[model samples]
Target chain A: MHPEPSRSLPEKAAPSLTGWGGSPAGPTTLLRPEKMRDFKPGESPQIARGMGRGYGDAAICGEGHTVLTERLDRMLSFDDETGVLRAEAGVSLADILTTFVPRGWFLPVTPGTKFCSLGGCLAADVHGKNHHVDGAFSQHVTSARIIPADGAERIISPDKNSDLFWATAGGMGLTGFITEVSLKLKKIETSWMAVKHTPTKDLDQTLDFLAIDDAENPYSVAWIDCLATGEKLGRSVVMNGRHAAIGEIPLRENNKLDGSFSKQKPMPFYLPSFVLNKFTVKAFNSLFNLRQGSRGEFVTKFDPYFYPLDGIKNWGRMYGKKGFVQHQCVLPHESARDGLRAILELVTESGRASFLAVLKKFGPEGRGMLSFPTGGYTLALDFANKPGLDEFHDRLDGIVLNAGGRVYLVKDSRMKADSLPYMYPRLDEFRKVLRQYDPSGKFASDLSRRLNIAGD
Target chain B: MPGIEGTALVLGATSPMARWTAYALARQGWDISLAGRDVQELRRIAADLILRTGATVSVREFQAEDLESHEGFWEDCVDQMEDLRCVVCAFGFMGSQDAQNEAPALAQQVMTINYTAAGTILMHAAKHFEEQKTGWIVGISSVAGERGRASNYVYGSAKAGFTQLLSGLRARLSKSGVSVLTVKPGFVDTAMTFGKDGVFLVADPKDVGGQIVEAMTKRKDVVYIPGFWRLIMFIIRSVPEKVFKKMKF
Candidate 1:
């Protein structure tokens, strides 16, 4: 049964919001609710927003309402012996790491950024470098409490309300407002990682290092130099890491599980647009290769190992006020090599230098219907927002579609509506679940509206 | 570091600042008693604290507006935890200035909760701590209390009363070996200022909570969260009265 509504409505304000990419800004009514009871649906359509790390329009609703879940963060309970934790969906992965890492526990699967809230992780079903080993974030979640359109709270798991569970797992907050989540955490001996970096000569070698059976480490990802061409195309630095055992660390580092790391320095202001062009990015790429290629093996803290960019707060501002878009797509194993080569060649030809490029391998298809991962190779590239960037991305999407690949919904801001069906074959199933739960489309976002995911 | 062996009673435990302060205290090895109007919410917070810190947590229903029951509430807290050595008052009401200006009742509610109710309970705490001759009391005041402004002077006036109350109590108990900390936070990213405009240099509640704990450990009397707020408030207080009255900030 539904609980009583809160005596007063949550604090509301109209704020101009944007995703992490910073492009496509719009004004939306934001509701900051402190408790579950305050999650009352109003006349306008609504979607839940966490830390706004989705990189696109998924968290922005425009004229609709965006219910912020950050304040709802609280650790509900934990099972020390079993390494299971129940926490409010608004709890950030950073908080979890701070609280549990020192106690010898770690997140089973975490995205590149720890600033993201648990609910956002579930909505996106985010994957990490260890996705080939541990699967997506939602796969580790045992159960969740969600407040759907009807305002009734439902506890869904993989076995109970399995359809709804799968739908909400990667539904992008389309099905409900995720309030709480319970997940199994991984146990670790230290808060550090033993990392090995190997520079690949070309695209083929990079793919070989990330091969499913050939992968020697639990976490693996490659930073590709997208500006390369011909024989040097896709030259990358492959980084592989595993949890450092107590014995593997130095004697002076006595607190093996010390989670404390260096503080973040804010990117004081937006760098001028001209500051990051092809010439500059290419130079930076060359220097990075030279510096990292020599660092063959080392022990590093988890913060820098997993989230190198997080060390610079608001690093996205470097993309300038106009912002940039991240296009991440996963191609099926059979056509991954060809697909990646074509995409890289196009990026090099277009002169849109992507300063940050990452490639990883995925395991089997995840349980979430719209989960982005599959047994394939995934590539993520960031491009500055320019006049012709939309047409450029369209061509990239065309190549991915031909290769039987799908674009990650969380990172997409301007893909065509028709591309949705081609990318996610399970769109019909996601739509079916939405119709059953929220027939009136109470929960909608700019992403859903642009792509017509609700089929309204 | 070893855990502190005393219990801390946190009033208005459901507020964001109180929740974080309680967490900071519990993490430092202090048992906690959470009191608030919403008993259900307090229970959830207590459970969370217990789970995270392995500290003993007790939930009690408290009505800040009911000044008469505060004395009994203090007794219950002392009865429940014999080693209660810290009391934190982290509760206040911020009514809309425009609405409070129109309704006398609204203004009264805001004044009573932020000043009268808070002051009454703190007096009881002051007596108990003074008698024990070894305890700490923390009051969460605001920078708004430092000056009167047209934007939120009603709420500011109440906070001003609270700030002075803490100041007076600190003076009265100076030689009693009991310490009182007056916390003046500016633009904290809490539920109270979640969507408010013109909020710059917003400090995270977690950091503010951690700083409060540090200040208490050092026995600091008055502190401005983020530290820079002291300079900002100092500049504001230095403005000439005629100029300040005409300025909108």
Candidate 2:
């Protein structure tokens, strides 16, 4: 039987936990502060971080002083004319999208999920659909207010403290704490997206389409069926898009809210574990494939196709008791097919079920030395945790390293210690920068330790 | 012939309470198909069930997140539980809230496992049970869900949502002759409660299992594993927000 891990919390204490998932933990004498001045690393918290989005454990405070940034959310400045925005580190992308998407502007970059704080985005140097054209969040980042390890606050950027700037860009909040940030935003003509959808018959067809379309579309992605093997191994649907022209904008009330304003109800509880068996998945996949059949040039709003998941609040609750692990990796184009094939084969042979599998064509390298994209094909799959999950992940990790690919830090929960260096060649360079700011190694996290990102 | 003698499909058959409840009912003469993530573990447990109850049993690998495989999983297990009578859902997670709070990825893991994944399968089971018109569904809930508490509140809140969903299912299926029972247990001594200390008057897993079986047989609306947890939770819920906010659980 799969053993469910449980632990007790200190009695009579109010527990305060903050993560992107809003997960509850045991009681602790911890507090979350919304204001930057309220946090005195020496007095209230030993360390401060913004937006706990690190997948495994990097942002978590281990039985120590923890500062949460949920309440620290405030947009300080935004130049609508120039598309320049400045905000507290705790400001979330969702907040920004809701406030600014319709104002003929867009974020420089965004991850798959838009729930991250601006500071968290800077800390991870996050990239997105436009990574090929725009680069990482750090490229757009102009300046930041940092609280160094020496307990001093200063504004650092590429021109000033360039050394600390690069380190803090994707430093996982180790170099120093980011209180606020200044960054450039992209200008858009309309809130609608001009999207083109192409359906492929198999894995090979999907890869060929990606290779050909990579040069044509700035944003290109394919959703594959991992369960299909042989001829239909990589059968998928390719979705390529760009911002819609003002003339192409659909007529809707409050176009600023975009077509994504509607909220989808949440699936309230754990489904009895049996509903997700092979038969159900196959039927779902077949129905999905059939439903996605060729629908010529469709003028659609951005929300349904681009952010179908965003509609459902707390959609992750569907995975049930043992949480799921999303394994996403980017392999060089040379090894893309083999790398993806090996991973999918392992999962299917092992009977691992994945509901969502996303395949995207990444462009050039971004600002962060360790950022995931690098002009390669990236594949992401959601693995529901079950027995032998650790072993299964270990096997996948081996495939990743062998292909000279690395798992995305934001989505990974299980990767071996040795795999980090192979994934990112600039590990030592980034390490040196982190050490200069956090010499004592006072700032750390479980993800940093697991992946050996932060050195002692 | 009475109460589905062919074979009972136990959905989360690997859980502590699920196993006990399955055994309790299987001993009373129902053949069992124990399905969960680790079929090897189910195999190991299946042998013991065969030895003790001398009833036919089978084990299958079923994952809630693997939405791609659910149809085949059901097909394979359907013949074994041909006229399935009952399904017990005891799969859940209270992952280190600390771990979840530290990682948005981790919190998504907990939320998915505790709510979405479980909800998906429960909905599937409800559909099948409705068609059969003679099956029963019993799920393990917690008193912590009666109201969101600061400690384990993420899990508690998820459970609260689950309790409400099951309650609605019970109401909807009452006419269909299918019974959906919500089993809300308070402080059951199992692996799930391993680390917590000073838990007041916790009941044993076996006792909770027995109560669930009794409730299922009697077709009770909603049951508190120990009965008193219901009254205790009622009092806890009655506390005014002004006073409750000041006083910690």
Candidate 3:
């Protein structure tokens, strides 16, 4: 039989796109699916994009179709009694938090940024500050509805299509386009957190403090002084917090929670590239440390604690027009100290100062095929995109691989193709599912093609 | 109206703008009756809005072309919500101007859906609000109603009449403490124009929803969505008839 000819498909108009990091993506054909029912996996290669909040090019498919799921967003159902919420894949974390936070419910797991979509979070298998206790975002997800290249919607859960579910949990949306997700939300007394600041000097104390001994405080994260050298190297101010009880806040009415969406200021335009340099970062880091250090034990809203960066709109533009690359890697507990120290040494020598470097402790390995978090300490550092950055990133990847650790794919823009299989041991299984779901390799992205990841 | 702050029956609640507005209203603590011809879509929107806002949301059968159903619908909304203080009529029909030029019947149907049916529903709502002596009647008119153009004069003409009717409704309903709002949105990115060619500067439903929330809270008589559409339409309305006829936009 002959293929259908002269069928008028959606026009392939070239449009320049970029991820949250502001890295330039080559022109691609964009499609906005207005409704969940309207999405179709046509003949052309395509990738589902929501909010385009991914730091890398995972959402972009250059010279191919890129389905925009922003319009497909709508809350499907939510059981107020059970706190089991179901919504379209395009719904943002900001929407969920804004609507549900005041209702005494919170996401089981949330990343630092709330602008990301449900599908994007699931695809990344994102881990939050609570990774030490709650694991990854996939663990909270009860079920998801995914449409493969064949356009058949399959509902996957831990018990149903378990292989596909686990593969898709961090499959980078290669298995299929997620249309809907049902997840359990944690009940909260208020949208406020009781926080304490503990100042740690040097890497050893910082690591020890990050272990978070107090069971009452489930969330712990450290903002390390990456630029510090000698005795001050790895000095950090650790913030430990837990949900604030009704009496924790000063409000007389215990039922009232502070779920305000205030303090929004736009960056307006890209700052000059030279604005963030060695001297500037050092000064900002010092100031930030002092600010954190001053706050001994206080009760604050969830936004400032979970998402301080979100207050400023277009905050990525502050990185400059060329954007910045964030390198985040995790090493097992045994090698964490040495591995993180080696990476920091490289950063110290590079002369490319990072304004902020974070360290967090993880509980155990997740079940997702390509889940980024494991039983380890993860170090995250952001560097302005400049000359010789690619080679430097490759060197850092080498150090991480040598330490038997892996880099977070969500934050990575330029990881080596060969290193992926080494880090994600279940890559073979994921590829098999991809082949079974999308046999013709119809689902692809710039990240997939560059990394030599196969869908068929 | 005595005990409840706001309870609305949203007609054509499945339309992009209306659906988003319903969610906004629910979030603002208004119990909503998501009434539309497509009850399936209405039910989904109602369920979604109820969950997000913790607002009482229910689906009802409301056909835009069914003018006879107006009386029973408003009564049913009041019965269900117990204190229906608002009726948001987001119903309109846009037809191809090219076809309207060729077929007179198509033009009449456009008038019937955009003008006749809407007025009947609003009239019933206005009477109910008049009896209660407190309510809101928000109508999402279009920027196309600002003036007639060759591109979509049929839609523009029908919308123009609808806008005029809303203006009259606003004046008459004011004495009874029933507020009326005319939302003239410019280019809106919606399912109707999903894959349409050559559309740009289309505002988001979320953004438009925010504007609707402001409108309801303030009870503005007439406003343009995105607010900028007001100026754009102002300039277009100010253009002389001779110049307007020559212009194609």
Candidate 4:
């Protein structure tokens, strides 16, 4: 039977916890902070978690405790004119949008889902479709307050405590517990997205479409059809979007506040795993391509444009009881095309039908020590964690390493420790920073131990 | 279910359940007056609520044993928050009966905080809401009061009186557009019970707080948190006194 998360608190131990992909359960003691005043870190090591949306163990502290930040959610202040906000790290993007959307403000850059917390976004230095324009999430952050191993709250910013600031940006909470964040917000005229879909015949055309400067939109993503092989390899639907201007929306409507959105319907139970096998997925991909090939420019709500899967609550459960492993990698622009094609071919050749695949172009890398983006093309694919898939993923990792690409830690649950230093050339620099900040290794986590990141 | 704009007063604000309730209502756009003994922590909670939801939150000086201080708070607080719509009382004392038996001062303090202090302050709150005729009073009592065991009946009996006060107030103020709710939370995980052994089916404070907030909004009365506690307490209360007296919880 699949593990059911009990609502009990004190009575619970060894709770089955997983990220969005829902694989590799970590044995952990759960702790929730009720008050921030006189808030101090316990003697034991810990990792702060909000909603646990990081796909893997980045938020899990295995042997140590996983501090639940749900109760810590609090939005502190906002500047109407400047579009700047300061909030507790536990505050979720959804909470921000619910309050700010009507007031004409949006997140600077958001990942695929709005369920993630500001701290989760910060620790991962997450990016979105606009990465080619805006950098990672940390770029817009002005400052933050963190409690280190000593339990002393210290304010870190780009200018003030520059060293600690840069180290904590993508230090993955190795620096300490981030208590608060001061961030600049993006102003939007309306919550509607004016989108254009350009269907490409092959991988080359997809890259060409993304490279077109004049036609480039502020937000861009491509849906890759991995089932198509040979000449039709990487056949994609390139979709670009920008916030809709005031005049572009229909007259006499509260476009800013009342962007049309449907009530989400939850998937009540798990569908069997075989439903996602090759034959069915191939049929779905062909139909998806055929339908998407003809879609032209249209105005849609930001909810659907930015988060399509959010329309179906618990959509991740569609992969069934075994859960899914999302393999996301980025190769520099120089080798992105060849590397992406090979990765897709590897999956198709292995006879595994991936339910979802996405491709995006990233801008220059940020100051984050472990930020996932480079000036590259990022490709994300999901494989249901069935038998033989673990070995298949190992082989896939080898391909990524050879091409000088690195898998995203937020999405990675299985990657060899040896591959880390090779993927990130500045590993030594980050290790030094980690040593300086966390002398006792007080911020131990399953991901850090697995990849030999800060726990080294 | 209510307007996103309004104000609330959360007494015993330092409790994990109360803190969660305050944040929950604030997120729904309610201004809150955080009343508790911890001035520093209460101020922090106030600042947090303000920052998190842009709600007007104030830290009011409160003492549970001081009955005189609870007398004149109603009109003063209502004036401070322009449109006060709800008042949630999440205050109590859970002292062991053994300690109370050895020291009458402990018994008096337990009775004072759990029932006397609550009733004294709530008398003013009930009047204020009744006169304004538009809000609710949430009283956080415990399920331990439902069927007092030998281990801790002094604390349970105090809560029982507190629960009855809310019921009477509910009946008295039903027509005045005022709601009185009694919440019976079962085994919550908080700082108070952090390391207590043999704790089973413990409720998450956030969940319990959320349930309290929802009940206040939906106008539910005499509710049991985590819902299952109703059945559990019902079974405990059903036992014959002689048989129940011999057994230990």
DockQ of each: 0.41, 0.03, 0.29, 0.31
On the 0 to 100 scale, the lDDT of residue A227 in model 3 is 81
Off by over 4 Å in 3: A1-14, A252-256, B1-6, B27-29, B65-85, B93-112, B123-135, B168-179, B189-204, B213-220
Query: What local distance difference test score does each model get?
Result: 0.89, 0.71, 0.83, 0.82
Give a tens-digit lDDT track for model 1, residues A141-224: 999988788888899999989899999988999989898899899899988899998999999999998884644589999999
Off by over 4 Å in 2: A1-29, A43-53, A213-216, A252-260, B1-249
Question: Could you tally the backbone clashes for each prediction?
Answer: 0, 46, 0, 3
Tens digits of per-residue lDDT, candidate 3, B174-208, equal 99988999988888887544555656688888788
Model 3: lDDT of residue A249: 79
Error of 2 at B7 (Å): 73
Candidate that beats the other on DockQ, 3 or 4, i.e. the better one: 4
Candidate 4 structure quality by residue, lDDT tens digits, A222-253:
89888989999999999999988887766565
Find the number of clashing residue pairs for candidate 1.
0
Put down candidate 2 lDDT per residue, B1-249, tens digits, no spaces: 354565667776766677678777877787788888767557645754654455777787778556667667666666555667677777777776667677656666566666776676778778887887767888777787788766677888788888888998898788889889898898876545533655778786667777888888888989998999889888999999888777766
Q: Please give the distance, in angstroms, between residue A389's alpha carbon in candidate 3 and its true position after superposition.
A: 1.6
For model 3, chain A alone compared with the true chain A gives a TM-score of: 0.96
Tens digits of lDDT, candidate 2, A1-456: 223433232222335443333333323343454235544344322344455555544566555555566545556566767777777777788777766775667777777667688888888787776666666789899898888767788788889888788778877777777887888888877777777778899777888877774544566678777777777887887877777776776676667336245567777786655667555776777676666646534656655655667677666666665556778888888888898888878867887777778887777776566666777888888766667888988898888888888888766666877888888888888889767766766666546766778755
Model 3 chain A: weakest 10-residue lDDT segment is: A1-10
Worst 10 residues of 3 chain B by lDDT: B191-200
For residue A19, give model 2's deviation from the true position in Å.
6.3
Candidate 4 residue runs with Cα over 4 Å from true position: A1-12, A214-216, A259-261, B1-7, B14-31, B39-55, B65-86, B93-112, B124-136, B149-155, B168-179, B185-236, B242-249
Ranking by TM-score: 1, 3, 4, 2
